[model samples]
Target: MVAFASLKCIIISSLLLPSEAFAPQSNLVNKKVSESSTSLAGVGKVVNRVKDSLLSKERSREDLKIGIAGFYDRSSQIWEEVWGEHMHHGYYVPEDRTDHVQAQIDLIDEVLKWAGVPEPTGDNKDELPKKCVDVGCGIGGSSRHIAKKYGCTANGITLSPYQAGRGNELAKEQGVDDLCSFQVADALEQPFEDNTFDLIWSLESGEHMPDKEKFVNELFRVATPGGRIIIVTWCHRDLEEGEEGLTKKEEKLLAKINRAYYLPRWCSVDDYVRILKENGAVDIKREDWSYIIAPFWKAVIKSSLNLKSLVGLLKSGFSTQRGAYAMFLMLRGFNKGLIKFGLITCTKPKE
Candidate 1:
C-alpha cells in the first residue's frame, strides 16, 4: 500500500499554486427506506435471502486515493496509446457512430452544449470563461480542448503525477501551455481560493470519491458565483418506491467493478441531484445518458484485443490488466441495466 502521509504530501506539493485549503464539514448521511410487506416484497425478500451480497461499503479515503493514483500513474500511457487522450466515455449520436476519437471529442462538445456554454467565436472573446478548473482531469485532454475551444485558461487537477506531467507536455506541444496547465491535487481538498473558477468540470470522477458529498461541495466552493458546473459519472439504478435495494448479483458485480477500478462506491443519479441541491446549486438538470455511452465499453473491449494494446496492458501492471478485463463486466452491467451513464449540469447562484 502507498503510504498515506507520503501521498498526501506529494499531492499538496504538486498543487503548484498557493491557496488556502477549504475544509467543509461533512454532512454525508445514509438513509434507508422501509420495505412494503406485499407479494412483490416477499419475492424481493426471497431473492435477497438466497444469495450473499457485497453492496457498497465505506473505504478509507487515503488508501483509495493512493490506489487510484497508482493505477492511473501506471495505466495512463497504455490508455493514451490505445484510446487516445480522453479517458472518459464517448457520446454516440446515431448509436452506430464508430470513429472513437471523434466520438470522444463529441462527448465533450455535447456536454458543453448541454451546459449552455457557447461555441467560441473570434468576435466575442468576453462571452467565454476567463478561468476554468477540471477536477480529476486525465492527461488534461478536456482541459486542452476547453482552452482551444474557448480561449480560456484551464487548470486540470489529477491525482497522478505521471498524468499531470504528460498533460503539461501535451499542452506545450499543442501550443496551449500558457492557457492550460495540469497539477496533482485532491478533489476533496482542492488547493484553490473560494470562488476562483468561472467554470468547474468533472467527467466520470464522482464514483471514485470516497466522500461524495464533500466532492460536490468542493466543486461548488471553487466556482465563482454564477459559474457553470458540469459532471458526467457512472451511476447505479435508483430504487423505486418501496422497492428493495441492489440485488445480490448486482452487488457482487459492482464489487468486482470497484476492485478493478479503485472506485469507492456508485450512487444513483438522484443522489447527485440531492447533493447538488444541498450544496446550493441552481438551474440544475440531470440527463440519463446511458444509451449514448454504452457503446464506449464495446469500443474499448475491441481496442483492448489488439496486439499493441495487449503488450501495453501487460507492461502497465496487474491493476491495468484487471481493469482491462473488467471492461467486459461493465458491458454486462450496462446491458443488464445495472449501470447508468449520468450527466448533470447546474450553476452557482450569483451572490
Candidate 2:
C-alpha cells in the first residue's frame, strides 16, 4: 500500500511536466508583438490547429524524436520484463482465459489473420514473404516471429537505439539473428529502397507519426508491387457527417494522451483509409477493434499492481511513470467511445 502511494505521487508529478516542457518560451518581444497584433482571432485559430496537430504547444521534429527514443530507452526493458517482447496491446477472446503473454503473441497472429496474411500450410514455409519490414518494431518480437514463421528475412526499425540493440540481442539469444536485423531508423523516412519489401507491417506506430500522410506514403513507397501493408493503430472516433472536427472536450482528452505517450496527433481510422487511397494504395481494408481491445488497459493496470512492477516503474524514470498514469485516461477515452483501436490493411497494386 505504501509503495502504491509513492507510485501515485510519481505519476501525478510527472504528468505536470509535459505542458511546461513543450510550451514555447515567453519573452518581452513576443509579448510586444502580441500586443501590437491586430488579428488575434487568426492566431487563436492557428493555436487550435497546432494544439490538435502537435500538442499543447509546438514540438520540433527533433524534440519529438528524442522524447520518444528517451521514453523507450528508459522503459523498454521494464516493459519486456513485465509485458514480454511484444510491447503492443494484447487481443483477448471472450471468456477465453489465457496467459497474458500468450495473448500478446495471439495479437500478432490475429492481426495477420485479419489482414489476410496467409501462413504456410505445407512444409515449405518459404511461400510467405521473402523480405518484410517491421516499422516501430519493439525489441523485434514481431520481426523474429515473422521471420521464423515464414522462413524469411525480417528487418525491424525503431527510433530507439536501445530497442534496436536489445532487439538484436534477443534475436541472437533466440537463435533467429541470422533471419532478423534490428536498426535505429525513423518510420517517417524509412531507409529502404522502393519496391523492396514483400511485406510492410506497422503495428501501433502510426500514432507517433507527425505527418500521417507522409508516414503512409513512406510505407507505400517501400512496398513491392502487390506487397501487403498492415497498420494497426490508436485513433479517435471518426467525425460525424457535416462535423468539421472533434469537439474541444474530445481534443483535450486526446491531448492529454498525446502528452503522456510522446504522440504527435490523433487521427481516425477513416483518416488512415483516406490517406492510403490518396497515396495510391488499393484494396484498402479497415476495422474498429475497440471492443476486442477494450480489456487491454485494464489488464495492464492489473499487472502493474505487483511490487516488482512498481519497482521497475520507479527505476524506469518519470516518462514511463507518466505513461503509466495515462493508462487510466486511455481507458476513459475508450469507454467514452472517444478513442479507438483501429486496424487498416491495403495491398500495393501490381504495376
Candidate 3:
C-alpha cells in the first residue's frame, strides 16, 4: 500500500501556504513596441499565422468524442473501485477532515450549496424539481443523488455505453431506478424535447465539449423556462482586452493535458459567462473553487498507489495509465494557477 500518512502530511503542508504563491504570471506585455510600423504589422501577420497553425493541429471533434468515451469505458471500473461513485474532486473541511470518501461526498454537497440548490424535503414537492437532466453524468452518481434528495425524475446521458449500463445498475442497486435513468447520448445533440427538464446539471463535462456554443445551446434547449442550470468544470484564466492570449508554454502544457484527458480544449470562466448571457440566461453567477478543490489531485495521486488501483490502471491499457500520470500535471497546473475549478449557475428567463 502507498504511504498514505506521509503523502497526506506533504499535501497538507503544501496547501497551507498563501494562495498568492500559487498564482501564475500574467501574460500581459505592458511595454510599448518601438519597431517600425511595417515591422509591427508583419509581426501581427506572423502571430495570426501561428494561431491558425495551432488551430489546424487540434484533434477532430468526432475523434475526440469517441476517444473520450473509450477512455471512460475502459477506466470506469478503476474509478469506481478506487474513488467510489463520484468521479469528480472533493471538498475538505478543516473540522471533519477524516477520509477521502467523506471528503468527496462533502465536495458534492459543497457544489450544490454553492449553486444555491435548496435541500429537498418530502413536504416541498412544489418547491423541488420534477424533472432533471444530468449532462455527462458519470456512472449516475450525481443523478441518483438528485433523484433521492428531491424526489425528482432524472435522466443521465453519456457517450459510453458501459457507463450508461453501469449507471442504471447503480440506480437499481440504490433503489432509485424508477426515479433516475441513464442512456448513451451526445450532449451536443441531446435526445430530449425542448423545455424538458426543470434542472440541467453538468459536472466536469464542459471540458469535453469541442463546440462550446452548441453545448450551451443544447443545455438551454432541454431546460424548461426558469429552469436552474448548474455547471461545474475546469477553466483557464481569462485574458484581458489588449492582452496577449496564452503563452506558448501555457499552450503546450494545455495540449499535453488535453491529450491525456481526452479533452478538446478549456475556456475561461468569463467566456462561459458571456455565452450564458448571450443565450438569454439570467441570474448568472460564477465562483472559482480552485483553491477549495486543489487538494483533490493529491488525494487521487495517493489513492492510485493502492494495489487495486495499480492493477486496474495496468489492465485498462495505455490511455488509462496516461490519465493516471496526468494527475501530476493537474496538480502542477493548479499550483501555477493555469487551471481553474469553476462553478457557474444561471436560470432560463421565465417567459
Candidates' C-alpha lDDT:
0.72, 0.73, 0.72
* Model 2, position 92: C-alpha lDDT score: 80
Task: Count clashing residue pairs per candidate.
Answer: 0, 0, 0
Q: By how many angstroms RMSD does model 1 differ from the true structure?
A: 15.5
Q: What tens-digit string does per-residue lDDT give for candidate 1 at 1-351?
A: 110111211121112111221112112100111111122232233223322222335457787889888887876775677567887777888878889789889999999999888878788787788899999888889999988888889999989999899999999999999999999999999999999998898887887888889999999999999999998888899878887788888887887777666777678988899999998889999988888876765565454333232223223344544554455466678789988888899999999
Best candidate (score: lDDT): 2
RMSD, model 2, all Cα superposed?
Answer: 11.6
- Give the TM-score comparing model 1 with the true structure, all chains together: 0.81
Candidate 3 lowest-lDDT run of ten: 1-10
Residue 189 miss distance in model 2 (angstroms): 1.0
* TM-score of every candidate relative to the true structure: 0.81, 0.82, 0.81
Error of 3 at 156 (Å): 0.3
Q: Any idea how many clashes model 2 has?
A: 0
Model 2 per-residue lDDT tens digits across residues 138-181: 78889998898788899999988998999999999999999999
Better of 2 and 3 by TM-score: 2
